[model samples]
Target: MPKDALISTQSRHRMTTRIWHWSNALCLLILLMSGLTIFNAHPRLYWGEYGANDDHAWMAVGSSQTMGYLRLGELRIETTGALGNWQDSQGRTQTWAFPGWATIPSHYSLADGRRWHFFFAWIFSVGLALFMVMSLWNRHIQRDLHMRRDQWRPSHIWRSFRAHLDLRVIRQTAGEDYNSIQKMSYIGVIFLLLPLMIFSGLAMSPAMDANWPFLTDLFGGRQSARSLHFIGAFLLLLFFLVHMVMVLLSGPFRQTRSMITGGEGKEPLA
Candidate 1:
């Protein structure tokens, strides 16, 4: 190999980080996919009409959820079960020890939808917890991805951005494991989007509704929570799109190998 083409192949990351990174990535993919499939079933948008839809109103006035327009054919199989006390369309609240006559929408295989969503969600949550714990424990996040004061400099950021746009920035920047773009994207996806997806999901869960009344308060209502969940999934999908483009631009094999085994080559001799 030529001097400039030294094929450095070594890993600096711990085994656990490598494992969780890919595992979380997979879980995130499934969560986003299935979540999107389900969301597509009910593309309808609704806002809590304070006066007219008062009794069934989900969120307080001024609070809003932007529900997306989903494509058809994502409906799950139809199934029904008893639901506890719930308000009816007439603005009269009724205690239904058994579910009332209501048409519940299923956007995919209802049974499969429930099963896959619940199961995959647990994996997603665990992966997130593990990643977060590992990041803090090793201080890896603080050291590697966090923005230092100097990084905020306009010249530094502009240089980093240009390099990232070309996928050549990482190669040129010294001691910069992640370019500014990478840092911003990873931080936004992992910290903001991931948590938003998880919390919004839980906020929509029936089981959680019983225990955490405030969940409804936080996200507006169950349906509103569902709306937020859809938005969060969309954000994850957006992240995945950019991530794939980056991987492609940067060389999938190179990027995948580095993520799996850490970047090649040990530190140079002093």
Candidate 2:
């Protein structure tokens, strides 16, 4: 066999990370779609413990006789034919928070949506817990994902940021791992954003609230928890978009093959 072939075939992603990565991807897709479907059941958001059509909403999506509007506090903007209100294929008027295309089943079904969301939520949560334990045990977190002391410096961060803006990715050599921005983004998503997502989700659940009232106190109220959950979902979506863009920019085939087959293309050792 050629030397380059031997080097290129070496593993880049660990078996565990690869499995978790794909599993998490599936779960996230299901959860996001179903969650949006569920969101359509309540298109309004409030700040306090109680809110409904009778009470003033901080944010709401609805339609009047003539046009659809999205109201944010005192401000309102027309959102006809997209959000708030639109006509379906049957030529019937419909009002929903998110468009049908953005949701699971592409039609309204609160019960089905909740079931999908909860089922995937459990899988996602359990998978995350197991991944965290395995990562810690294998020292993968410490060894590969950790930011070096030098990377914490403003100069290093600025340099990395500049490199990213210039579309100059620092490719990983045989022994090296992720670049500074990659490490930071991974840390933020895995350690910070995900935990917040899970906690806020639990806080919004009535069953969980009954079992652990402290969750409600921690997040202020159920409405607040719901708001936070929406925010977390948005952040996760943003992360996923950026991640896909990076993979394409960095070499889609190479990056995807690494995740699928756990191999990296040959690179000179640093």
Candidate 3:
């Protein structure tokens, strides 16, 4: 139906790319769930050098005897079943910001959550570092992700965004070279957001803070770094959700098969 759909399916994902894709996916899943467990320990966010129970929080998820709510500055909204308060698996009422099913241990245990978070965190960090080096060595970054001068123009970007919104481009290109918008999103996730998530996490560590004060200072403070880390994780989650939808919408079987086997269905174009 479309020109690119009829184009060659000769393009194959490299082994490193395929491995990194799935490994990164698993790492993010564990990190996010466990991170939620850790967040339930505080359930509040603040800016600047220090924050405490007595101090003002820019955002907080809390509950009263009768209600669970999310407070954002001066605004408050009830979130009884999902945030601030929810029932446990056994139907016992709990007052955690996130539900048990969404967290790692499915129970309140900051210690255990931290253990799970840190263990997978190392895997995520190491896997990301290796992916980057391999990507560079293979020139995958330069050849595949690099955008042409015309693709950077406002008109070109707008068209690409519109195509993504309508699912036109992805359905056509599928396993072919990524469109401009796709490349930019991948670039941001790979080079910027992932690194920020890692370094800001390190900035929140007490040992890193004491040994490398500059890391903490770079992000303003431990609390600020924590805030940034949460934000970065949120952005990553957003990307993952949208990426999944795109893959499923375009053709999940074809895409998944390519990533797993590192080969396309068709040998060459018509």
Candidate 4:
């Protein structure tokens, strides 16, 4: 085997990371779809301890007989034929906040949606926990993600940001080395957004409220926790959109192959 090829096979993603990456991806996707279905049950968000039809909500999606609209605070947007109301594959008009295609079961079933979301949520949580421990144990986080002292400089940071904006690949010592922006994005998603999604989800549960009242109180209230969970999920979706664009620009085949084989195309390193 060629020396460079050998290095490439051994140095990019670990077997554990690759496994977690795909499983976590699957988990998040289901959680998002089912969570959207659950959200359709109450397409409104509030900030206080409790929320209901009569209360003022920070955001809402509702449809009238002929039209659909999304209201955020005082501003209202007519979302007709898309959100608040949309047609399913069968051409039946749906009054749900999100259309059937975007949700699990592709129909209005809060109970089923909750089941799907919660089942995947557990898988997602366990995957994250294991990934965290493995990354640290393998020094993947420190070796690949942590910024050197020089990378902390404003000039390097600015350059990295611009290069990312231009969709330019910054090949450092090796092809697998992530730029500072990549590191930060990964860190934010891993340590902040994903965990927030999990905890806020727990905070909304009646069992958590009963067993650990402080968890609910930590987020101010149930309504606030729900709002935060929605926001976190949105941010995650945005992160994935940008991540896919970056991958496409950087060569999806090579990047995806690395994740798939994890550098051991024939015999994986033990």
Candidate 5:
């Protein structure tokens, strides 16, 4: 890429978008860490209305008399040292849903975990709502994130998929915008995944159920909502991982600078 070409490129991320992006990133990290800490209280998942120690769980992480295990439905796998059973700082045996390193507070404190989770949950929810409204008002969603009719074509989608596999990122000069795959991903995250995560999180709240029983009904049950919430979190984590990989592969410094300062750098080589 020539110096002139780099200089010619314009802003890739708007100020509001960049603000929301960073804010959301921070909120998500807090939420996920606190959430895992909360999950350590149960370390098991069940379907339908109710579940307890006596009740059958669809998934569980626990240590037996002999070894640690992760039970998924009927299948059980020994996951000692990694998941089910691990030694603590004092050399005490500990069993938790997620490892201590994976959670906030890094120890058993359901109260503290809940407090952190709810505080950030409010921020995440309100921030997301404001961002969406602003995006709509500014036509950011319509002009940049929305998929065009041509993008819906099978051939176009296949081409985009192939390009992604080839790590080919189509560089925009000035007026051009995100590619079809980028548009679809942004749309899915903004409209579908994030909302689902919020709703599922709300559904798990006993207060939410008391005020709006419909949420529990909507998701079939509280336990079902909890399961969905976990699934959504896992999916979001996967998205984050993929996003980071794409950023590194595309152009770490250039892409990061564009987000931070809204100035483009040299195009990344395919």
Candidate 6:
């Protein structure tokens, strides 16, 4: 008999957890790709453009409002002449000019973008909720990600931080299960990114606004919710990028295969 066979080996994963994990991953990828395509219509951020400003800035689909970012609604309008003058929120008139050689704002179907986003959003939400429920029911959240109070101490955090900064961590645990660094990252995505994305997205919709008036206050305002949505998207994208790198470094095939097959022949422990 193999010597390792003498040691007790507990199952590392469950079918439900494995399914949820891969489902979430797939949905997130779809959402991210579609989101990028939508944002490419107006990839900019702006401040103090919405509401009674000076108190808050605004972020929309584009990088900045000054960029004359194209919107789906105006996608059908073809411009024949120089960009005209537009008014800023402060009641100031400004000329919307673009270099002759530069790309001009192209009109697109706002309805189409909105439809795709809203539809995919439902799948994303379902995946998120299912993942959360399973994680909570199985206590996997606590089991896999939550740090005990002792581990939350300054020394532990500092150790993880130093390992991260020194690049030693990447060398030590490239794949396998999540380390402390990964636990923190996963926690952020599960609690912070998922909730923020859902709530902010809902807050922007009129139907949700009518049902949950306080949501606007929670996020400041509708436009504020829109801003939060964009910010949340950026954070999710960041997580996705890091996650892909970890998978690649740790051995994508095995990691992905394990997720799909629930770890070779490992069975549920309980």
Q: Using TM-score, give the best candidate's number.
A: 3
Lowest-sum lDDT 10-residue window in model 4: 167-176
**Tens digit of per-residue lDDT, candidate 6, span 1-270:** 333222113335567777767777766655555555455454433432245323322332222234343333334222223232334345544333322222211223345546666676788788778878877876777666776676677788778767655455665554434456677888988888888988988887788888998986688877677667777877887888877876676668777776776555432222
Clashing pairs for model 4 are none
Q: Tell me, by lDDT, which candidate is best.
A: 3
Cα error, candidate 4, residue 3 (Å): 17
Q: Which segments of candidate 6 are over 4 A away from where they belong?
A: 1-11, 36-107, 165-177, 264-270
Tell me how far the alpha carbon of residue 216 in candidate 6 is from the true structure, in angstroms, after superposition: 1.2
Q: Which stretches in model 2 have alpha-carbon errors above 4 Å?
A: 1-10, 64-66, 87-93, 170-176, 265-270
lDDT (C-alpha, whole model) for all candidates: 0.59, 0.82, 0.87, 0.85, 0.82, 0.60
lDDT of 4 by residue, 1-270 (tens): 544345335647778889999999999899999999999999999996899999999999989767899999999999999998787788877789998888997889999999999899889999999999988887778767787788888899898888876644432222556777788899899999999999999999999999999999999999999999999999999999988888777777877887887743423222
The deviation in Å at residue 123 for candidate 5 is 0.9
TM-score of 4: 0.91
For model 1, the stretches where C-alpha displacement exceeds 4 angstroms are 1-12, 47-107, 170-176, 265-270
Candidate 5 regions off by >4 Å? 1-10, 89-92, 168-176, 265-270
Candidate 5: tens digits of C-alpha lDDT, residues 1-270: 654334334456667889999999999998999999988899888888788999998988887535688899999988987786887778777777677788887898999999999999999999999999988876678767878899999899888877777644433322245678778888998899999989988888899999999998998899999988888888989989989988877778877887899765334322
- Please identify model 3 stretches exceeding 4 Å from their true place: 1-11, 265-270
For model 2 the TM-score comes to 0.88
Q: Report residue 86 deviation for candidate 2 (angstroms).
A: 3.2
Model 6 is weakest, by summed lDDT over 10 consecutive residues, at 98-107
Clashes of each: 9, 0, 0, 0, 0, 12
Model 1 TM:
0.68
Q: Candidate 1 — worst ten consecutive residues by lDDT sum?
A: 60-69
Model 1 C-alpha lDDT per residue in residues 143-205, reported as the tens digit of each score:
567887878788998887777666465444433366666778888887988888888788767
